[model samples]
Target: NSKINLAANELLFREGEAGQFAYLIERGRIAILRDSAGEYQLLSELGAGECLGEMALISHDPRMASAMALEDTTLTVITRDHLKERMARSDPLIRHLLQLTLKRYRQSLGQTFPDTSSTQDLDYLEDEQQAMQRMRTEHDLSHALDKQEFILHYQPIVRLADRITTGFEALLRWRRDDGQLVSPDLFIAVAEESQIIEKIGHWIIDEASQARTRLASAYNGKLSEDFYVSINLAARQFPDPELPGVVQEAIRRHGLLAQQLQMEVTESQILENREHAISVLHNLQSMGCRIALDDFGTGYSSLAYLNRLPVDALKIDKMFLDDMLSDQASRTIIAGMARLARDLQLSFIAEGAETEQQVEALSALGVEHVQGFFFGRPFALETKKEPA
Candidate 1:
């Protein structure tokens, strides 16, 4: 084995290079990349003790990817000639292991390739027909909304420093007729483009408020009266001048207090049309409701808008906190934001705190609240009492 050192950002291998050697990493990390339509796509990451270039060595073919060192790295290189020489002197079991590795590599390549052939062209036409049929299925989904195919789930946001459950965020999910659950990502965009977001947003407000009322009644003066429910507002629906009046009516119908409900708007939505969004936010706030800037620091002008808007809270974007343990810059930024929140008297929450390390870091940073899979996944409103 030959030892090689790579400097930070150095290219370890180029795509389509002849692979004569496989490598075992001894230090640092490498990112594997594939070229797609002339642009590089990050495929996977490899760290210490991980092997790379093995696919090419096993298949005796050109390298399928380009790899680059993320930091200074040390690697142990084993040439294909040496491996073949070892195989010649090894037992049948070693030869079988090498053959199995080649078979797996070919299987993986087959799974990654796109289907393109004369028969595949015909299959493509058939697939288009299937896609059109699926469009019809959307009509079923549209109709099912009236039948309650779409429902709201609540996930609690607890104050990490105090362990107090301050509020629940309402999340949407779809229960399809085939018993398959569809993610909101698949349908929410379609609904927004079709202008159905307004109806759905209103539905969420009514349902969540009613559920909050029921929970309060069940707890019967044992739980904090300030326990609130938060729902996301679609940007398109915000332009309606009647939104405050509509929400007020929903509050009256559910016998819920206005301050017990909050509205979360994404930073991108507010930054896109700051003047109009600020106006809408002010209107909502005037109606005795609280406003939160969701996914903060994720959009252009997010910090600028935060200073201008009358928002009560800032939910730090999850991506920033995800790498806090490994990235000093992320931790520094989050800690700085928490300090800014304290100075501004704005409540701060870190979303996507998935580990004990992340929780400890946020607590140390003085972030008031935390939410993520570490606490619990979103659950149906009736099931909220279950452990997080």
Candidate 2:
């Protein structure tokens, strides 16, 4: 469900009202109320990351209490359809347990719920808890930005033929106050869902540009003169009308050529809004920045549209190479991708080459570049004396 905001002292719902939806508090506080002797009495107050009115949604009954905003509040609405959709995927055993639990829950309130099949409250409840955790993480991410707790680590992109460092990919990392690095997988999706990724993405561009300057100076000509730092563009970033301007500003601010900065977008991300993605990529390309179609062959990479898009490179996804040694189909696919990249006059970068044999196999296929742990793991900016 989408989010809604309420001002202080606003009534969210009244007692005996039909439960059209439940709500998960993303921020601020809400007060639960009950009418007694013609006066509303407070039962409880729920702050950020709390869920309410779920029992009514679970039982298909009227709200047992009233709810009012204790302060300005941000809430995520949970509808009956949403609950039902979640239930459809729940396990049979879990569903049975939920049926019994919901039945007992209703009975405790002196009411009977006749429909046992409607019991999916367990999954709904679990999702509500997960939503609260996600909300908490999202809030922390927003604060992390203000705290400058985010970091960028550079991973080398190597030339396959000579195994020389040609460029690097800027990888994002979150370093909390405890100095423990948090994995991007845990927070990136939350940030994306919350739209905080746009701000975080812009920050990445600026940080990467600055890092490029440092890396160029520190490498002592070991890096290719045409060396570029590739920054991944989140799916949300492509539709942003201001994205081109943001990249242009970063390039200019770093006193670097646009070619020194590369933008990486996934195949699925591009397909999400093809027209808009094309327009944005073309705009960036016109500014002389490179655009790479990342994770190629993993999605609907139609040749019909591939020729039309403004892409400079094709980074073959790791899965193709992970099975290439044993799977002839994988080898054939890689060979075909190599030829396709050649035909399109695009740089072909094979990703996730961890072993010597994998590298040799990719090099034999005429894959020009490779990126993975075999070349170098991502390292901090200060350790820039050599490829890491």
Report the number of the highest-TM-score candidate.
2
lDDT of each: 0.77, 0.84
Candidate 1 per-residue C-alpha lDDT over 1-388 given as tens digits, one digit per residue, 9 for 90 to 100: 7899999889999987766788999999999998887998999999999999976544445677899999999999978676665655554334444545655665686533322222422533444454455455557666766977777777778787567777878888888877677888877765665557777777778788878866556432224558888888878777766677778988998788888999999877876677898988898888888898888888777365467897998888789887899998988899998899889999888898888888888888788888777776677645343232
Score residue 356 of candidate 2 by CA lDDT. Answer: 88
Q: Write the per-residue lDDT of candidate 2 for residues 1-388, one digit (tens) a residue.
A: 6999999999999987777899999999999998987999999999999999987655666777899998899999988788676666754345555656867776797765354333634555565556567767878899998897998888889997776788999999999889889988888877877789999999999889878878887664257877999999999988667778888898888788999999999989988888898888999999999999999888976777888999999998888889999888888889999999999899989998999898988888888999989888888777333332
lDDT of 2: 0.84
Assess the local accuracy of residue 88 in candidate 1 as a C-alpha lDDT between 0 and 100. 53
Model 2 weakest lDDT span, ten residues long: 112-121
Question: Which pairs, if any, clash in model 1?
Answer: none
For every model shown, what is its TM-score relative to the native structure? 0.62, 0.72
